[model samples]
Target: MISAKRIRIEKNQEVSANYVKKKMDFINYLDNDSLAQIFMLLPISERITMKEVCSKWQEACQLAWHDIKKYKCTNTIVRNHKKCILTQRYVEKVLFNCGIYLKELILSLICDSSIMPIIAEHCKNLKTLEFALVEFGNKNTYRFVEAFTQLEQLKVVKIHISGYNFQFRMLNSLPKDINEIHLFFKPNGSPEISFDSGIIKSTLFTTMLFNSDPVAPSFFSLKKFTNLRSLTIHRCIITDIIQEISRKTTLVYLDLEKCKTKKEIFTFNQLLNLEHLNIKDVSFMDIPNLLSGIFNACKNLKHLDAPDFHVDLAEIKMENWVNWRNLVHLNIRWQASDAIIENIIKHCNNLEFINIDELNSESTIELTKLENLNHLDFEVTNIDNEVMVAIINNCKKLKHLVLPEYNMVKASIFYDLSKLQYIESLNLAFSFKLGDSAIIAIAKNCKLLKCLNIKNCNITSSGYIALTGLKNLEELNIEMSVNVEDNFVVKLRGIKSLYCSGCHELTDTGIIQFIKNNPDLEFLNISFNTNVTMDTIIAAEEAVKNRTNDTFLAIKSVDSDIEKACHEASKNRTNDTFLSIKTNDPDLEKACSESQWLIDC
Candidate 1:
């Protein structure tokens, strides 16, 4: 009699399963075309989300989205989409409207003399200028120098020197009233840079350089820039720069990287206004002296990135960490004792960013106390389940989180990460263990994610499909995920930037359709793949060209081919239309010159 009762209970469980099956079957009773018309009445936001309901609903949502794009809607409410993008063309138009009130401008495209007049005449209040030109530079680039001097209010300028002979042009164009200057030279054999101290009229508070190599003898002295508040140099000769730089009461950000002796310790001690210090690139033999000097000088340091300390930890005293109580960002990029890390956590109570390589069990305990950490990046460190859970539970204010790659952690750890509903950026790139369940978990819970990098992960087509629900995701990196197919383009929309460099499954049709779907896409890196051909690239260029419609651009060269090309480009050219390359190939250079007007390209 008991066995008979158990069989009856088992039969009752099957009833619920069969009922769910019957309900699912009922939804497919209507054809997708009919279901799509009903779904089309919903808002675009809801229509995109409905794709994740089930296979049948996903099909209907795909069709509904297509119809919404093809057929214009009479409903004003359905058309209210808040679209925003920042591109070369977008900024050019925006400056025309708001140049007078603009306080900052960042340009990263091939700058022609075409817009220099507008900037010089209207952008009078511009204070900060980031001239991040990655294009091949030539004599025409120097023409902007005259316009730069007109912006008498410009205080900070960062110019990336790409081509030759423009360094002096930068110096002459920059106004004497500039307070901060950062010049980064590209690694393309830039000419020896020289600094004329006589031209500088105002006090330079900040000076930074990147690969400004073989600088003139006068560049190392910096005799005029005596009141530097912060100075940074990368891949340049630091021996003379450190030895000759005069120490002023205002010089605080220099001691950590340049000075390491007992005599220099007193100068650092008085620098109470120290801002940022990084010594990762410097080779240090005296670890104890370096640490002591930093401890003495870094009383008010807000940011510090220290080098590897794989030394005798017993020789160093961990008691000096209390002096770093004001540190807000600390990056210890190597293995250190648990005691030092514990001391850091205990004293650096205001730390908002922490980057460490390896964390032991003891340090993990200390990490749990940093409940307000906003950023964490552990480089290739395997975080166990307990440590991962501790972080997810404690770091409530984390907006950017990077877990360890190639770990043995369970896939369920992603579910823990998804609990961070407020997180804006999450990176799980190169994790062999991350699969469809992790993506599903993020889709179901992590609604506020704006940037997600799953590059070269173990995600499959189902995982890629699950990403359709991430409506707020603006930047996505699924590069090298071979399983990524055209279905993603059919569902995902409004992505401003996408990097699918090695996705072998993507074809021409999907890419062109994607470009059409997301009209505001600013960046796309579909390189290293053959399925996406030049035809799709031409379509992308046409879409951007139709929007920018810049029918005229000035060319200084006397070449007729360039003039003809510019005239044609005025009628058809868009950003990224021509590849700006530094090649020795004569044919390639000739081919790019006609279109780009840059001699090197």
Candidate 2:
């Protein structure tokens, strides 16, 4: 009995509604592969939240989980596992819910013995395992090793034993196919275990022993690893391992940092394939001969960290480094002359990084010829303006320049630095000569600067305003810089970490306003600002709570009389507060200890 015209209008309206709903379903239009790709771009927390949106989103999250391969538990979170059951439960939940298989697992905590069996059962495809600060009972050690042996695909294993009454013989239960083994023994503890030459003779590729007793019996001989490529021994005597190392012809990387060894221990002619050699803190009275022998044989060496001893350049020639064309990184604490720099520039054309103690005018001139140099650490007694200009103008690709403890007297140095367009990080700590003009030049020119450290400089409030031009700056450290007042805090923008400790000119109004503007700032250090009271602390807490994000604010002052007053002010706070207040007052620290908001005071 309805009218035909009315029925026709209703049909049209229904069709329009369906069309609009179809247009709104944008995510449903994407294919499964595209949705999975989008899900992979999200952070872990967002990804977890996405699974509740729809069935399609859940499927995409599953696909994303399949791509994950590594899991790590930090040391601090694991330290609380002994007393906090919630921490242990959270770790277990993350492990079980993420994925079924992981390739690498690194735990820097004391793991429970029962958890290893569960990990072995679920993560059967694991290949690399590392544990630091491990504690195990006498019976649990064997069970832990036995559970690890079930993983047929394991390739690398590293363990640092800190518990007492645990024997090293438990290592014999490890699978024979492991290619790398790193073991560290604590002080005053010795393990009663002997290595059978046949156990590790076939497939070992790398070995490291750290902090072992010097007088302990040799566990094994490295000569058995016919395919060894890297070996590292630290804080132990090398007298017993020298012969075994001499026979490793396939060694490519060797590190003997802080090892007790003499000059005659290194006759490294047999290691023809050696490319990276680190001998830091090793006393070598005959350094010239040792270096000559290494340069003659290891022509393919690419990275070398030589001894801290002095080398007489008069005894060596330019031709000695002629075959070192492949060297790219070098760290030497020795004094060198202009001739040494000239030879290095002429031969090592591919040099990209260098750390040295001294450089003269002529030597700096030679350093300008390195077109591929990206990092330079130069410490000198005096540097003139001309040398600084020449180096900055020539090294166009320089990214990191560190001049700690250098005597820089000229303000023209800032003008020279502004020419470096690609520089990202600059450290001029203890250079008391730099003032407002230098900071302004840096802010105007260095567009890509991300980290700036001008600690203990003569920069004032007027100079600090120039930093507002840096849009990409993420870290700024102006500790001990004088004359910083309220106006200086208003100009900061887009900074994730700000360090302004010892700036006594700062007050409560400036800091509270700064915190409100930068609500997402993660770290703020305003220690020694005596004007900052409990009102500033309350303002910071409010700002962070409104955003629902975690932020750390440090406000330690020399005045201790307000400890009781601050403690009384913070007692009413709840556990839901998102701000962590760090202070030096003992009474306030004890009061904040019960609240979850206090991280470390």
Q: Against the hidden reference, what TM-scores do the models get? A: 0.62, 0.73
Instruction: Give one digit per residue, the lDDT tens place, for model 2 in 415-481.
Output: 5788888888888888878778878888899999988888888887667888888988888888886
The clash count of every prediction, one per candidate, is 0, 0
| TM-score, cand. 1 vs. native | 0.62
Instruction: Assess candidate 2 and give its TM-score to the true structure.
Output: 0.73
Clashing pairs in 1: none
Q: Give me the displacement of residue 234 in model 2, in angstroms.
A: 5.2
lDDT, candidate 1, residue 551? 23
- Per-candidate Cα lDDT values, in order, are 0.60, 0.66
- Report residue 538 deviation for candidate 1 (angstroms): 1.8
* Number of the top TM-score candidate: 2
**lDDT tens digits, residues 343-368, model 1?**
76678788888765655755765676
Each prediction's Cα RMSD?
A: 19.1, 7.4
User: In model 1, where is the ten-residue run with the lowest total lDDT?
Assistant: 70-79
Off by over 4 Å in 1: 1-154, 163-178, 189-232, 238-240, 243-246, 251-270, 280-288, 308-320, 333-335, 456-460, 528-530, 548-601
Error of 1 at 353 (Å): 2.5
